[model samples]
Target chain A: MKSLAELQAIKDKMKDKVVLREGTGEIRVVVGMATCGIAAGARPVLNAFVEGVNKENLSDKVTVSQTGCIGICQYEPVVEVFEAGKEKVTYVKMNAEKAAQVIESHLKNGNVIEKYTIGANQ
Target chain B: MKELSLNILDIAGNSVKAGATKVGITITETDETLSLVFRDNGCGMTKEQVENVTDPFFTTRTTRNVGLGIPFLKLAAEQTGGSFSIESATKEENPGNHGTTTTAFFYKNNIDFTPLGDVISTVTTLIMGSPGIDWVFTHTYGEKETRIDTSEIRAVLGDDVPLDSYEVIEWIKSSLEEEYDSFYK
Candidate 1:
């Protein structure tokens, strides 16, 4: 079993680093996680974003989280991106691969992969 | 669902949606049976709601016309020659003691039994998705066991530090993997 003491050590070491980035992210990536979303394979999409953001070293600027049903059962596995002073962008019928693309294009380069957006699906 | 862990994630999400401050999940495996129990300290359902929960068409959410989380889980267990049940006490009925407990038993020997895949990801996802909720998880395979309590972790890290921090989430994933590793060794 892993000890709580080791967890304590991690906290002590990362405490300062965590404080610097706390609640100050400029972009938010929210994945739909309701029943509809889960059945449509949103878990991997969510994981892809989290891992993608971490791997790209964008953790300080981007925060990936989850939301409940967005009322679009036909378009399950939805993802919404919220950035300061911009219209919220909704992506529909997403997968892990698309998530990585979204991170690379929209989150990284400020190019909102409009092809994957809900507007294109509609 | 393709995997049982996904069902666990879906069902536990219900607990979170119910405003549960603390959720307890236990997976006990034996030679023939795999049992799952999810208990929460949240607003429970009424008798009528509990009765309708397993119906695919019934849902608490106004956003969608159907709810499949509970129904699918029930089907998953029953398909394996197992059983599923839910008990709840609404806040109006039980006052401060309101909550829900869902249990399912699966006969692992049955051909229809689904594999429990990537539970570490399911758990870490839940923790990251809802850091304010204290999640207590325990999985026992015969004599070996793996356990984690977010409340304990929170006590160590204190309120200023969030459980969903990248480093914290990574630590949790590795810790769980280490525990599972010891089980095999």
Candidate 2:
């Protein structure tokens, strides 16, 4: 069994890192997780983002979160990325593979995959 | 949804929407039965709302005309020759005790029953989305049980650390993985 003592070790190591990132400008990745989003397979997309972010060591620079319906059920499984001063870029009809690509192109490279954005889909 | 875990995610999303601070999810499995219970200390709903929850047309949101989460869950459970129910006490009526409880039973032996797939991911996703909420998840099968409570982890980590931090999430994942490993052993 994994003990709480191990959790303490993790806390001790992460305490300084988390404290350092407070209020720092970072990119925000938000996934739509309402009924529409889940039905359209948002879980894997969300998972892919989380795993990808952690794999790339971007946890400190990019925060992944979830939100309810965005009033665009047709664009279910939507993802939106927000940088400090830029307009929010919403990506529609996303999947796990596409999520990885977004991580590589948009999050890691600082280039919005305009083709995947809701603007192009609409 | 293809997986019961997805249904769990969908249903619990309502609890998050209702401003729940504490969410409890319990899964109990017997030879022929798979039972699920989701309880939340949220804003709850009106009696009328509870009565109409299984109706696909009933929704509290103005942004959409249809709500399918409860209806789909009801259909999934009933199709397997099992049962589903929801009970709630609104804030106006129950005040400090307001919340919602949803119970569903499924005959696992039934051919049409959906599998509970990748529940660990569902739990982690919930925590990642709502780091402040207290989540208690327990899964019992045969003579073994696996459980995790965010409140306990929070007590150890202190309030300064977010539960969704990558390292914390990784720890949660590995811990659940270890417990689940022992379930089948």
TM-score of 2: 0.95
> How well does each candidate superpose onto the true structure, as a TM-score?
0.96, 0.95
Q: Give the TM-score of candidate 1.
A: 0.96
For candidate 1, the TM-score of chain A alone versus the native chain A is: 0.93
Q: lDDT of each model, Cα atoms only?
A: 0.92, 0.91
Q: Is the docking of candidate 2 incorrect, acceptable, medium or high quality?
A: medium
Candidate 1 lDDT, B89-149, residue by residue in tens: 9889999799999999999999999998889999999999889999999999989999989
Per-residue CA lDDT of model 2 for B1-185, tens digit only, reads 88999999999888999999999999999889999999999999999999999999989988888999999898889999999999999999999899999999999999989999989999999998888899999999999999999999989889768788888988999999989987866
Interface DockQ of each model:
0.71, 0.75
> Which segments of candidate 2 are over 4 A away from where they belong?
none
lDDT of 2 at B170: 89
Off by over 4 Å in 1: none
